[model samples]
Target: MSWGFWRNWSIGTRMACIAMLPVVLLFASFMGYSWYSHRIQVDEELAERGRVLARALAETSEYNVISGNLSDLRLTIRGLVQSDASIYRVDIVDSSGHGLASVVSETALAPQRLQYGAPIRKQVIWINLFSDNGTPHITAPSDIRPPTVTTTNVGEVRVTMSPTYLLGKQARRFRVELAIAALALAASGVLAFLLARSLAVPLQEAIHALRAIRGGNYKVKLPVSTGGEVGDLQASIGDMAIALNLSKQDLENKVAERTRDLLASRNEALRADADKRKLIQKVNSIVEDERKSIAIEIHDELNASLIAARLESQSIAALAGKLNAATPAPEIEEIRLKAQAITKLTLDLYASGRRLVRRLRPEVLEMLGLHGAVEEMLRHYDSGSGCSFTFHSEGDFSRLGHDLAISAYRIVQEALSNVMKHAHAAHAQVSLVLQDDVLRIAVADDGAGFDPVLSSEGIGIIGMRERVYALAGTMAVHSTPGAGTEVGIVLPLEDRVNVS
Candidate 1:
C-alpha cells in the first residue's frame, strides 16, 4: 500500500495493527513448528513399533517353521494384524528367502506404511571334554572345559505398519493446540484494541484542540486523563492555547490603542487644513481691499494731477505758437517744442495711471457680472496676443456672489495670461459652465506644453490654486511636453456664493 493509503487510517487502527500482527505471526510460527515435530515423532514411533512387532513374530515363528505348520503361523500373524490397526501387513520367509505366510489387514488401502524386518535364528551347543594336553584327571589335574553356542539364520519376518492412525492422533492434538492458540490470539486482539482505544482517545482530543487553535479559537479544554506521551501532549497543547489566547488579547488591545491614536491624528490634520484655507481666504480678502483702495487713490489723485499739468503745458504751447507766428525766431521755436514735449509726457503718464487702475480692479466685473467680465478679458487677450482665443459660457453666472465673481474673473485672467506668455500656440479655448451648484472652468491651449513635474510653480499658477483652495474648490492642470495644456477648475457655487 502507498504511504498515503496507510496514513489515512486512524491512529487507533494503526496502533491495533501494530500490537496484534506480531502476536499473530508468532502463534502461526509456533503452530507450524509443533505440527512438524509431532508429525516426525509419530513417524518414528510407528517405525519403532513395526520393528518390535516383526522381531517378536520372527522369534515365535521359528518352531512353527521347523515343524512346517505354516497355517498356524498365518493364523497368528492375521490375529496380530487384526488386533492393531497400525499393523497393516505381516510376512514370514524361510532361510531360502521364500514367503511362507502372509497376512494383510482388511482396512489397509492406500495408507502410507513403514516396513521392518527381523531374522529367525537356530542355536547349537558344543562342549570341550578334553584339555589341550589331551588328559583328564578326576581328582588330581586342574584341567577345565567351556561350552560354546552356534547360531544360524533360519527365516525372516517383515512388518509393514501404516502411519494413518498415529497421524490422525497427531492431527487431533494439533487441533486442540490450534484452538488454544486461536483463543489466545482473540484475547490478545481484544486487549490490543482496548490499549489502542485508550491511546487514540487522547490523541483525537489533542488533534481537535490543535484544529481549534489553528482556526484562531484559542479557548479549548483538554483533560490529562492518562500518563506518558499522550498526557504530556495534552498538557503541552493546553499550555500553548493559553499562551496564544493571551497574545491575541494583548494584540487586540494594542490595535485598539493604535486605532484611537490614528483617528485623533486624522481629525487634527483635517482641522489644520481647514484653518489654513480660512486664513488664506482672509488674507486674499485683505489684499483685494488694499488693491481697491490703491486703485481709488491713483484714479482720484494721480489722474487729476496729470490732467492739470497737461492743460498748463497746452496753454504755454499756444503762447509760444503766437510768438513764432509774429517773429520767426529760434527762442520762440525752442519754447514751442518744449511745451509740446511736456504735454505729450503728461498724456502718457495719465494713460498709464488709468491702465493701472483697470488692472487693480475691473469696473466691468461689477457692471456685467462674472460672464461679461470673462468675455471682456478674453476679448482684450485676443486683440493684443497673436494667439487666437475662444470663449464658451453656460448657465446663469450673474447669480454668483461678488467675492466669487471677482475670484473667478481673476482665475480666468491669470490662465489667459499664462497661455499667451508661455504657451506658443495658435489656438486657445476658454470654457465656463455653471450647473447644479457647481461652476466648472476649463482653459485649453494647443501649444508646446511643458512637463508639470520638471517646471517650477509660477506665481500666477500658485495664486490661482490658493484662490481655488480658499474657496473650497479643486483645480487640476493637465499638460505634457509637445502636447497641449488644459486647466480644469471646479468650484461649488452653493458653498461660495449667496445667490440673492
Candidate 2:
C-alpha cells in the first residue's frame, strides 16, 4: 500500500501499523548486528586460549622432556590446568598408542584412532597430538599442534588437549548471549507497544470526535496537545465547524431580510391598489356629474341662444326682401351686419362650449372609437398650438380590444397635455403599435424639456405614471433640461376590459 493511503485504514489499524513498523525494523537490525559482534568476540577469545595452551606446552614441557626427566611432564601439565576453572581437561599421549595422563578427574579419553599420515578435518580444528590411536574424536589444546618426532634425549611424546571442553565453555557463553538477545527482543516489543499506544490513543480520540460531529454533535472537541499531523487535522476541523456555523447564520439572516422586504413591498402594493380603487370611484362620480351638468347647460342655455340668433337673422333678411341688391339701403345694410355678427358670435360660442366639454371627456372616444378621437384631438391641438403634429399607426386599430384602446388613449392624452402645458414645444409626434401581443406607445415632443427626476412633484406626470401602473404597463420618461421629452409605454395587450 502507498504510505499516504494508510489514512483510509481505521484509526486503530493505521496507528498500530505506522508506529510499530520502523520500531520493529530498527530493533531487528540492532539485534542482528549485536549477535554477530558478540559471537565474533566470544569465538576470538576461545581461539586465543587454544593457541596459548598449544604454545605453552611446546615451550615448557618438551624442553623439560629434552633434559631427560619424563616424570616432570605430568607435574607441569597439571599446573597449567589448575590456573583456570574454565578448562575442562588436559592430557598427553605417546606415539605407541599408550593411554595418556589426564588433568580432569574421571574424564573419558574417547580415543582418537587415526591412521598415520591421514588428513584431518579443517572446521573441526583438530590438532595432531599422537596417542597413536587409529580412531579420531574431539581434540583439545594438547592435540592442536603437529606431533613431535623422536630424538635421542627425549622419548617421542604425544600431547592431546581436549578442545571438546573448550567448546563446552564456548557453548555456555553463547547460551548466555542468546539469552541476552531474547531479552533484548522482548524489551523492544514492549517499547514498541508503548510507542504505538502513545500514537494510537490520541488518534482514536480524534476519530471519536469526528464521528460525534458527523452525528450532529458540533460541540464535540478532540484532545489538545496531540502534537503532529493529527493535531493539525483536529485544529482544521475545528476551524471548519466555526465556518459552517457562521455561513449558516449568514444564510438565515439573508433569508430573513428578503422575507421582510417582500412583505413590505406586498403591503405597499396593497395600499396603492386600495388608493387607486377609491380614486377611480371618485373620478367616475365626478365625470357622471359633469356630463349631466354640461348636457343640461347646452340643451337649455346655449341651444336657446343659437335658435334666437338664427331667428333674428332670418327675420331681418325677410324684412329687407324687397330691397334692391344694387341700391341696398343703409338701414338694411346695418341690420344685415348686426344680424350677421350675432349669428357668427352665437356659432363661435357654441363651438367653444363643445370644445370645453370634449376636452373634459371626448364623446368621440365613446362613439366612433379611441383611434378617431385621438386623431381629432391631435388635429385640434396642432391647429390651436401652431406646433407640428404627426401620428403613425401599425396593426389594425379596429382589432384592438376596449381596455387596450382606453389605456393607449389615456397615455397619449396625458403626454399631449404635458406637451401643451410645459413643453413650449414646436413639434410633437405620437406612435402606437401592436406587436407580439404587446402594445407599444411612444409620445415625443421637441419642447423645452424639464428634468424627469425633478418633475415628480407634478400631479400631471404622477397621474400619467399611476395610470400606466394601473394598466400593468411600464412607462419611461426620457428627458433632459432644455431637450425633448419622450414618454414610452409598453403594455401587455391582454384586453382586460372588465377593469371598470
Candidate 3:
C-alpha cells in the first residue's frame, strides 16, 4: 500500500506501527551481531585450550622419546585423551613428522574441531666436579673443553578437541540474549501504545468538536491547554464559530426589518387605493344624477312647448288653406307659403329636443336591463356615425348589482365614444362574458389605431380606465399606429358590493 493507504488507518494504529518498527529492527540486528561474536569467542577459546593441552603432552613424552620407550609414550597419550571429554584425539610424532603414538577418544569427532601442536626438544645433563668429599670442591672436567652443547627435535604432540562443548555453552548464552530481546520487544510495544494514545486522544477530541460544529451545534466548547498545534487549532475553530453566529443573527435582523417595512408600504398603498375608488364613485354618482335631472327637465318642459307650437302652426295652415284659392292676390299666396314654412320649422324643433333628451340620459337604461341598454346605445351609434357594431353578451346581469352594472355600462360607453370620435373605424365589436365568477369585457375596433401611450392624453381612455379601477377591475389597452385598438377588462363578480 502507498502512503495514502496508510493515511486511511487510524492515527493510533499508524503511530504504533511507526514507533514499533525501528525497535524491532534494532533488536534483530543486535541478536545477529551477538550470535556472530559468540561463535568467534567460542572457537578462539577452544583452540587456546587445545594448544595448552598439546604442550603438556609434548613435554611429558619428550623423555620417553629420547629413551626410545614407545610403549610409555602411547600409554601417556591414551591417558591424556581419557582425561578430557572435549578431546577427540591425541598424537605424538618423531622429528621426521612421523607419528610414533596416537590415541582417539570414544566420543564422536565434531565437524568443527580445534587442533593444535607443540614441538618436543631433547635435554642433556653435565657434571663439572668429582664426588670425593662433600666439603671440598671445585674441579673442572676435561670433557667440558668447549661446553659441549647438544639440542635436537625429538617429536611433536598434536591434540584435536571437539568444539561441541563450546558451542553448547554459547547456545545457553544465546538463550539468555533471546529472552532479553523478547523482553525488549514487549517493552517497545507498550511504549508505542502509550505514545499513540497520548497523541491520538487530543486529535480525536478536536475532530469530534469540529463535527459538532458542522452539525450546527455551536454550543460545544473544547478544552484548551498547552497541547501544541492541536490545541491552537481548536481555539481558532471556536473563534470562527462565534463569528458565524454573530453574522447569522445580524442577517436575520436585517431581513426582519426589511419585511416589516415592505408590509407597511403595502398597507399604505391599499388604503390610498381604497380612498381613490371612493372619490371616483362619488363623482360618477353625482354626474349620473345631474344628467338624469337635465334629461327629465328637457323631456318634460322643452318638448311640450315645441309640440304646442307645432300644433298652433298646423291650425294656422288649415285656415290658410281654406281661404286660399285660384291665384287671387300675390300677398295672400305669400301669406299661405309663410304659414307652411312655420309648420315645418316647429316640427324640426320638436325632433331636435327629443334627440337632445335621449342624449343626456337614456330612460331605456332604467326600463330595460344592462344588456338591452348597451344594445340601444350601439344602435344609436350605428345610426349617427354610420358605423357597424357587433355586440355579444352572455350570463345574467340582473343580479350583478347597480354599481357594477353602471360601471361596466360607462366603460363601454366611453370606449365606443373614442372609437367614433377618433378611430373612424368602419366596424367595431363589443363582447361581454361572465364565466367562473368573473366578468370579461372587450371592445375592439379595426381602425387607424393610435399609440395607447400617446392616446392617454385624451379623456376617453382615461375615463374608461378610471371606471374599471373604481370597480376593482383590471383593463389593458392594445393599440399601435395603423394597427387597430382592443380594450379588454376583467372584473371579479364577487367584488360587486353596493356603492354608497
- Which candidate leads the pack in lDDT? 1
RMSD of each: 5.6, 13.9, 9.2
Residue-level error in angstroms, candidate 3, position 424 = 7.8
Worst 10 residues of 2 by lDDT: 114-123
Candidate 2: regions farther than 4 A off: 1-54, 57-275, 278-300, 303-348, 381-390, 399-407, 419-429, 434-440, 444-458, 471-500
List per-prediction Cα lDDT, in the order shown. 0.89, 0.66, 0.81
Q: Write the per-residue lDDT of candidate 1 for residues 168-243, one digit (tens) a residue.
A: 8899999999999999999999999999999999999899999999999998887788999899999999999999
Q: How many residue pairs clash in each candidate?
A: 0, 16, 0
lDDT of 3 at 141: 75
Candidate 1 residues lying further than 4 Å off, grouped into runs, are: 1-25, 42-110, 113-168, 182-200, 228-233, 296-323, 327-358, 362-402, 408-436, 441-466, 475-489, 495-500
Model 1 — TM-score against the truth?
A: 0.70
Tell me the tens digit of each residue's lDDT in model 2 across 76-123: 766666665334455544444343454662352332221112111112
